[model samples]
Target chain A: MSRIQSVLQALKGQGRKALIPYITAGDPHPDRTVELMHTLVEAGADIIELGVPFSDPMADGPVIQLACERALEHGTSLRQVLEMVKTFRSRDDKTAIVLMGYLNPVEAMGYEAFSDAAKAAGVDGVLTVDLPPEEAEDVAPLFAERGLDPIFLLAPTTTEDRIRAISQHSSGYIYYVSLKGVTGSAQLDVDDVAEKVSRIHALTSVPVGVGFGIRNAETAAAVGRVSDGVIVGSVLVDTIAKNQDDIEALKSSLVNLLKPMREALDELAS
Target chain B: MSVKLTEEMLRALPDTRGHFGAYGGRFVSETLMDSLMQLETEYLKLRDNPEFQATFDKDLADYVGRPSPLYFAERLTRETGGAQIWLKREDLNHTGAHKVNNTIGQALLASFLGKKRVIAETGAGQHGVATATVCARLGLECHVFMGSEDVKRQSLNVYRMKLLGAEVHAVESGTKTLKDAMNEAMRDWVTNVDETFYIIGTVAGPHPYPMLVRDFQAVIGRETRRQSLEQAGRLPDALVACVGGGSNAIGLFYPFLTDESVAMYGVEAGGLGLSSGQHAAPLCAGRPGVLHGNRTYLMEDENGQIAGTHSVSAGLDYPGVGPEHSWLKDVGRAQYVSVTDDEALDGFRKLTRVEGIMPALESAHAVAYATKLAASMDKDQMVVINVSGRGDKDIHTIAQLDGIEI
Candidate 1:
């Protein structure tokens, strides 16, 4: 089984919900990424979604877009991001690591070479923000050969036909964008999310992880109640943006920032 | 060369999935799939509806001034001392360019789709102004996303859009130019899928857009085909048009696809020389990549990151071209070349002084290439160049270059 499947299964067996935290790999500073990965694990993250920064991240809002800009300013590339995953793997093997990015970088490296490098670097899964299932034909089999879960995004606008098509290709949990807008653009409506999550459950066996517009413990807990996982992104990246100059304070605040959401999710699970 | 394709065969392309032979596809986020699917359905329906065709036709003739004259350039031909040359007067459209043709068509579609608001992204501000004009005419709300850099460079066009009552949002992301403005527009479309219609300025973007924009703008080529036979008593030996996102070029080339006797050239913006790494000639120097929701030839770095493009013509300063152009280039139905900024400037001056016609900077690139092509051919051979837009918008840039404040 892929790391994502194993981790989610174990969490279900233990009757606890999963907390997935997203961070851009080279944000603030590349040197501090591995350390931050460890910090996120310590803060009760069951899975880590590491953003491989692209020059143009259209689906992302201003917060994550700025985060990508910061990460790219230091000349961080896809190969470097994979190397960071290898470093994090040396310290922690239990937490599932998914490399989240746009398709161009992988296309630049070619599928076979990227898959080999990703697997060698200990990446468990990948979620290309722009590569929907229709275009994932060439890349999907390569990831499967390398034992990498190819995650897909399902949105409020996705039809049942599309959901079925996506679920067939998606191996890791499907990311459910909770709102109609880009990341960090809208307020989460828990009721609507619950409705959509239930509809998605009817279509696929894949675990649904709700994200986009998910911020703070209250929102996370609300989302955690309906979905298998609550994936938080722009909020964490915003914290990193605020404390980029102070790495020590950045780590401390990230731990503090995630601790409440973890506690809130655990409370619901219990 | 690929198979010799007739116009029917060419139009049959983009298939159901919008693939123009591995060139165009709806490579977009899932948030947009359903919306694009809906748009595809609506477009496929209205694509053949008589009522839709009537409205589009009437608007093209009355509002946009159709059959923009195909004028013979006697002085240019004499000066070049080569082939007889003709100019397709797209520069004389209502909005001073051919951009209004597509916007008027899309605006009517927006009305039919019951969309209350329309959005567009522009590089030269011509498309933005064109879309804003249509929206103002139809009483629909309009929002135009433009690069902050372009906002500064083309402030007059920005004011024009505002005068048309459109909101101009200056995008500050990426290279802060045309490509970034497109990204912002795509994001807005994904967000406001239900009530907003994205009026893509060119024949790029995903599936229906490339095909739809081409269909609307094909009036240029359709008219040229008849006009060429009438004026020249035969098909022209060569056709030339500048290609930014390739709308004007494709529009002028589509009708001549089956007429294998006519040669075609698509001129790209060479900001400097090709070796200088500053030009925006993707078809000439770049490789194929997926961008702005379609697969096309794009100026990208080794890592697949879109490279910053440079061109004296703001409209041509984009990394990617329309997918159909990529297909046409691969199939060898059309030849894609480029002209440097200096050469295009020379073309601008030559046309103004010799022909008494002020061509847009983007159109000047075609004139530059056409001059060279015409000079190589016999005088009996006829060459037709699409003067895609007027030079009024480029006057400020020209003055700046000449060290004179406008």
Candidate 2:
């Protein structure tokens, strides 16, 4: 089994929800990404979502957008991000890392090359923000051949037919955007998310991880009740934005913010 | 050598998923998929309905002043002393630009879809003004997204859109240009999909949009074909049009795809020069990548980040071109070239002084290329250029560049 599937399956067997934290690769600085990934794992992240910074992140709200800008300013590329993942793998092998971003960089690198490079770098999965099922038919198989789980997004506006199609092709986990708008949008209704996530779960066997609009422990706990995983993004990036000048403070604050959510999610599982 | 494309074959392109030969597809977020699919279905139904066609036709004839003259440029011809030059005067259309053609068609579609609000993104404001005008006429709320830098440069257009009862939002995102405005507009559409209809002003974006915009603007080429047969006694040997998102160029080139004898040329904005790295000439210097929901040639770095693009003309300051243009370029059906800012300026001045017609800076790129092309061709051959917009909106920019206040 792939790393993501093994990790998710193990978590399911333990009756505990997966905690996934998303941070833009090379944000603040390129050298600090490996350290942050380890910190996220230490803070109870079962699957680490490392964002490949894009110039235009349409699916993201202001917090992640600013993170991307910071990462780009520091000269972060898809290749550099893979190198960071490779460095992270040098000491650790249990934490599953998923590279999340838009599809242009992958297209630029070509599918076969990217899949091979990702597998070599120990990337367990990939979530392309703009690539829907209709566009993923060509690249999905390439990823599967490399044993990389092709993750997809399910939103409030996604239709049942589309959910069926997306879920059929997706593996590892499905990211259910908790709100109708972009990431960091405020108005995450826990009841709405619960309803949609259940519907998604009925259609596919892949674990559903709720993301977008998850800001704190309460929301994470609420989502963890209805989901197989709770994925946090903007809050962690927002914390980094605040402590950009102090790397030590940024790492500490990220851990501080994630720990409560981890405990809360664990409590629900228990 | 290019294959002879039939009218029927060309019209049947962009099969169901909106793929224009591996270029165009619906690459949007899942939230916007249902809306786009609904739009495509609605468009297919309305595209063949006679009543819908009649209304669009009526609007083009009565409201937009169709059949804009195909005038022979006697002075420009004499100066070049090669190909006989003709101008398809799209500048004569309502709003003084070809952008109104697509806006009118989309506004009608929006009304037919029962959408209460209409949103558009613009760079030069001609499209924003045209969209606002149609929304005011149709009694729908209108909003236009523009780059903050464009808002500062084209303040007059911003005021014009507001005066026409549209909300003008200045997008402060990446590079603060047309691409950023489009990104913001897409975000807004995803949030308010039920009530809002996004009227993309160019022949780019996701599927159906490129095909739809090209269909709306094809009136230019259709009219030119008839007018050329009447005045020149034959189809012009060559066709030239400026390309930003490639609306005007594709509009003029679509109807002539089967005309194997007619050569086509698309002019891109060369801000300074090809080597300067500060230009919007993607077809000439950039590579293909997925951006703004389509696979097209874009000004991007090795890491696939969209590069900062520059152009003297606000309308042509985009980092990517339409996917159809990309297909056309790869198929050798058309040749893409670039014109420097100074050369386009000279074309602007020459046309005003010689033919007594002022052209927009965006259109001036075609004019500049036409001059160079005309000088190299035989005198007996004929060339027709789509004068996509008038120069009134660009006076402030021209004056500023000339070191004078308006």
What DockQ does every candidate get? 0.80, 0.79
TM-score, cand. 1 = 0.99
Tens digits of per-residue lDDT, candidate 1, A98-149, equal: 9998887887888899999999999999999888888788888888888899
Give each model a TM-score: 0.99, 0.98
Question: lDDT of candidate 1 vs native?
Answer: 0.92
What is the per-residue lDDT of model 1 for residues B1-406, given as tens digits with 9 covering 90 to 100?
A: 6458786777678888898987898888888888788888998899899999999999988988887999999989999999999999999999889999999989988999999999999999999999999999999999999999999888989999999999999999999899999999999988888899999999999888999999999999999999998988999999999999999999999988888889999999999889999999999999988787888999988878788999999999999999999999999999999999999999999999999999999999999999999999998999999999999999999999999987
- Give candidate 1 regions above 4 Å deviation: B1-3
Chain B TM, cand. 2: 0.99
For model 2, residues B1-406, the per-residue Cα lDDT tens digits are: 5767787878767878887787989888888888888889999999999999999999999999998899999999999899999999999999899999999999999999999999999999889999999999999999999999999988988999999999999999888999999989998887788899999999999888988999999999999999999998999999999999999999999988999999999999999998999999999999999998899999999889999999999999999999999988988899999999999999999999999999999999999999899989999999999999999888999999899987
User: What is residue A114's positional error in candidate 1, in angstroms?
Assistant: 1.2
- Scanning candidate 2 chain B in windows of ten residues, the lowest lDDT window is B1-10
Model 2 agreement with the true structure over A192-265: per-residue lDDT tens digits: 99999999989999899999888899999999999999999999999999998998999899999999999999
Which 10-residue window of candidate 1 chain B scores lowest in summed lDDT?
Answer: B2-11
Cα error, candidate 2, residue A233 (Å):
0.6
